[model samples]
Target: MTEVDPLALDLPVLASLAGSAADEFLLARLRADGHEHIRRSHGYVFQRLIAGAPTVTELGAALGVTQQAASKAVIELEQLGYVERSADAADSRIRRIALTDRGREVVQLGRRLRAELEQTLLATVDPADAAAARRVLVALLAASGGLEAIAGRSVPLPSD
Candidate 1:
């Protein structure tokens, strides 16, 4: 059996490295494709929109940003023609933000880029190890209740 050095390896180090690697991987792929205007934070918003939710203030609360900031981002994206703002169909007085064809294209492309990255990250691992990682990840997220909070509207994140 190989001896493991506990001092040389730690969870914190691995977690930090994993985050940095993921960020670098994403930005490298997306930025190369001329997606410099999209920020990492926009991923959350995109996913939320995909799930059929639309509202700048709600997105702001979930992202821990002010409504004004969220609205600004929406405006910029709208100007880029990726998103559209219109009167809510159900409520004429309220406004809703939706992904235009350009927005959906960006989201789909983002998904493909992320999937490719994930495949490379797990490429060398044994199938059993990969299955275990998936199970552990699911369990950890479920236990943490992070997704549950965000799954519904007006959920919150840590305020900056």
Candidate 2:
């Protein structure tokens, strides 16, 4: 193994790098499976839609983004055949977003890939170290209020 950079010793930097690498790995797998247009950002939308259909405005609020931004993401996903917008049954004027079959498949694939990644990590690290790392990560999330977001399945995407 190569010498680690001193800056990579920082928790936040190491976490970000690890996350990026994991995302790249997942994206590559998705592409190989014919999900070429999917991006990591789409996960934000998918996470919410998995629970139930929500209006763009509602989805925006859940994602902590502006309505227009949320609408843009929905449009992109709709174009990719991952999601669909339909008139709300209660109010035709209102539009609700729902995941299409393709979207659901991607979500399932992501879950499987995530489990595979975790298994790989467990295999690579000592059992005790893996348990400790999981505890530390959970504690960090709790300290940062990320635990709630994750529990609610509405973690916001970073601003561009």
- Please list the C-alpha lDDT of all candidates, in the order they appear: 0.74, 0.91
Candidate 1 — which residues are off by over 4 angstroms? 1-7, 142-144, 150-160
Most accurate candidate by TM-score: 2
Q: What is the C-alpha lDDT profile of model 1 across 128-152, one tens digit per residue? A: 9889977765565566675576556
Task: Give lDDT tens digits, candidate 2, residues 35-55.
Answer: 999998999999999999999
Estimated TM-score per prediction? 0.77, 0.91
Score candidate 1 by TM-score against the native.
0.77
Q: What global local distance difference test value does model 2 have? A: 0.91
